[model samples]
Target: MKKIAILNGPNLDRLGKREPEIYGHTTLADLEASLRAEFAATTSLDFFQSNHEGALIDKIAALADAKFDGIVINGAALTHTSVALRDALAGAHLPTVEVHISNIYKREEFRHTSLTAPVSLAVISGLGLEGYFAAVRFLLKR
Candidate 1:
């Protein structure tokens, strides 16, 4: 079975409460369950989350052995600051899609720039949880 890794970072663990207006009222687990149900018959997914940068990197490094065919990542706050995460994704060399539930560009100036965008195959934003599902579909087509 083909496997995909859905990696989330930082404050995203508290999605439902963190930024209810931007991230929606859905918790991360709730969104995961929906994603699983949506992709259940199509592919297997390994879901992981971490508030620590090293832990996220560690999880991604472990996937270097062809364990995951693709990756959908919501790097959260790290998307703007973490070169380590960007480096890990590039080193993995997998088809990667960066997801963002909110429209970063329309918000604060600080959220406008993404350090990881240069290394990603695609960036899906402003569509909330549906953006993640879109990334999954893109992988399916690939």
Candidate 2:
């Protein structure tokens, strides 16, 4: 089976509750279940979510060392702020796709820039949970 890691950073664990107007009512667990059910037959999935930058960076390193085929990451608040996370992703050199529940382009000015985008295979934003599915499907095909 092809291995893919889905990494979520900062405030994403509050998916259903944090900002329902923008993030929707679906919890992270619900999203995971949806992804697992959709791709379980053909892909081996590893899901990790953290509020800490170091933990997420550590996961990127571990995934790279383990030779994961691809990654789907929603860096959340870290997307614009963490050069360390961006560096980790770049260093990993894994085929990575960045995801966002809301369109970062439509949000606050700071959210518009993503340090991780330059190193990713693609970035899927504004599609809600579908963005996650899209990222996984794109990676699976790649």
Candidate 3:
């Protein structure tokens, strides 16, 4: 099975309860369960969520060292601001897809820019949780 790491950053831990209107009502655990159910036969999914940037960076490095096949990351707020996170992704040299639950272009001006997208193989936005599935499928095919 393909090994994929799903990394979520910052306030994503509050997914279901945090602005249900924009992010929808799916909790992080719910998302993980759904992804597992959807891809369990073909992919081994590992999940990590962190409110701290260093934790995320460290996890990415660890995933690289462990030879993970791909990464699906929802950097949340850090998507717009963290060059360190972007660097870590680039350095990992793994196939990566960046996922955003909401459309960043449709949000605040600051969100229109993603520091990590440049290092990602693709960016999935505005498609809600389906974006995560799409990302995993793409990576699996790759």
Candidate 4:
């Protein structure tokens, strides 16, 4: 089975709690279920979430061996900062799709800038949970 890695960073574990109005009431586990079903016949995915920068980087580093065919990453708040994560992803050299629940451009000025998007094959934002599925489908195409 072709495998994909779904890496979420920073505060994603608090998805439903941190911003219910924006991120919706879907828990991380619930989202995983949705992603699993969405890609059931298409791809097998390993979903991981972390709040620490180093842990997130570790996940990226550990995947450097090409164990996964592609990646769907929601860098969360790290998208705007984290040069280390950017470097790790660049080193991985795998097709990557980045998603955000809320429209970062429309939110805080700080959220307007993303250090990671430029390196991603595609970026999906302002689409809520559906964006995740969009990313899954995108990976399945490749």
Candidate 1 deviant stretches above 4 angstroms: none
- Provide the lDDT at 68 for model 3: 99
* Model 3 lDDT per residue over 1-142, tens place: 8999999999999999999999999899999999999999999999999999999999999999999999999999899999999999999999999999999999999999999999999999999999999999999999
* Decreasing lDDT order of the candidates: 3, 2, 1, 4
Best of the two (1, 2) by lDDT: 2
Runs off by more than 4 Å, candidate 4: none
lDDT of each: 0.91, 0.95, 0.97, 0.88
Please give the lDDT score for candidate 3: 0.97
- Candidate 2 residue pairs in clash (backbone atoms < 3 Å): none
lDDT of 1 by residue, 70-134 (tens): 99999999999999999999998888999999988989999999999998999998998999999
Error of 3 at 60 (Å): 0.2
C-alpha TM-scores of all predictions? 0.97, 0.99, 0.99, 0.96
Q: Which stretches of candidate 2 lie over 4 Å from their true place?
A: none
The true-versus-predicted C-alpha distance at residue 88 of model 3, in Å, is 0.3
Better of 3 and 4 by TM-score: 3
